[model samples]
Target: MRCPFCGHEETQVKDSRPSEDGAAIRRRRMCPACEGRFTTFERVQLRELTILKRSGRRTPFDRDKLARSISIAIRKRPIEPERVERMISAIVRQLESMGETELPSSTIGELVMKHLKQLDDVAYVRYASVYRDFRETQDFARFLGEEGLNEVLARER
Candidate 1:
């Protein structure tokens, strides 16, 4: 592998092991030219997937982008990082197992919303506000009421 630190042509792997979640392989490497050490993760891609956007545009599916969006929703919401990672892995696995090369963006969004609802209400609302494009306070009220979450929120207080 190419060394990220000094742009060396090759690096030696000092150690290799499965990650905590077992979704990826973690490798520790050292660059001979600069002796810089860094960690890398390798994941298996079952196939190349494409995202069918709402606007009739197709784009390659990006795991990092999905992780970033979930991170934004769960930021400071008391959810464990390992749980978030597993959630992401589960979502990806579900998508891949569907046996389709292309999938609607809504599918991914709904999956996220579903998982967030089970994970945390605040994170769910945070993601829904953006995904559903809430325009006013009434939107949240309507959503909470429609989803029968107001009672849950009230009970918590």
Candidate 2:
């Protein structure tokens, strides 16, 4: 691997192990030229998946982007980081096993909604506010009512 610190051509792996969730291989490396150390994660990609957007534009699926979106939704929530990581891995694995190279963006959003709904109600609402393009407060009320979460949210408040 290339050294990110000094732009060195090579780095030596000092240790390797499976990630806590067993979805990726975590490697500890050191750059000989700069004596800098860093960690890298390697994951198995079953295939190259593409996302077909609503705008008719196609783009490669990005795990980081998905994680970031989820992170935003769960920020300051009581959820654990490990749970979020596992959820993201599960979503990616499900997409890969779908046997289709190209999938609609809506499919991914729906998967995220499904997982988020099970993970946390607050996070689920946060994500839905954006995914469903909520224009006003009534949109949230409508969604909560539609999902039968009105009573639950009222109890929390």
Candidate 3:
């Protein structure tokens, strides 16, 4: 690794450890010339995946965009951030395992809804309303009824 302090071409790793989240490795480095120490992180980059939009457009898969959508749906909810990250990772893993370079937008939406349904019913409904493009109040009612959320909501009364 290059030294950041002196812009030297060579640096030695002094220590290495897994990050707190276990998602990456933190490495402590030292510059031989300036004796300056610095830290760097390393993470794995999986094979590139593509998203096939409804418009027939293909775009590179974005984990942050996926996280933002889920976060918006679960906003103000009780779900933890770690859980959300795990969910996104699981979804990405599943997509990658399919051995397909491109996947339909609807398939991705279904996967998100499936996971959200288990995480939080309200969040699930909130996401479904947008994903399915609910047109009226009855659409919400029907979805709640079909998902047995009506009964779940009743118990909270």
Candidate 4:
């Protein structure tokens, strides 16, 4: 690696460790010429996965987009940032393990709902409002009844 401080041609790795999330490796390096030290992170890039929309259009699966949507639902909730990152990584890993390059948008939404349901009821409801395209209060009422969420809500109240 090139030294950032002195722009030296070579640097030696002093230490290496796996990141907390295990998504990347963190390396500590030293520039012998300047005696400068720095850290670098390395991550593995898997094959690109595509989203197969209902309209027959295809687009690359975007992790940021997924995070944004989930974050919206989780707004004002008590979920930890680490938990959110873990959830996103888990979903991506699950999809990648399926051995399919292209996946349906519905599949992604369902997975989000599954995780959200376990994380927080309010977030799940908020996400379901958008994902299921809920129209009226009756839709929520029906959802609560069908999902047996009525008891959970009552208990929380």
Give the winner by TM-score.
2
Clash count of each predicted structure: 0, 0, 0, 0
Cα-lDDT of candidate 4: 0.90
lDDT of each: 0.93, 0.97, 0.87, 0.90
Clashes of 4: 0
TM-scores of all predicted structures = 0.95, 0.98, 0.75, 0.76
Query: How would you encode candidate 3's per-residue C-alpha lDDT over 8-94 as one tens digit per residue?
Result: 999999999986657668899999999999999786656788999999999998878988899999999888887887787778778
Candidate 2: worst-modelled 10 consecutive residues by lDDT: 148-157
Better of 3 and 4 by TM-score: 4
Q: Judged by lDDT, which candidate is best?
A: 2
RMSD of 1: 1.2
Candidate 1: tens digits of C-alpha lDDT, residues 48-147: 9999999999999999999999999989877889999989999999999999999999999999999999998888888999999999999999999999
Cα lDDT for residue 133, candidate 1: 95
Output the worst ten-in-a-row residue range by lDDT, candidate 4.
40-49
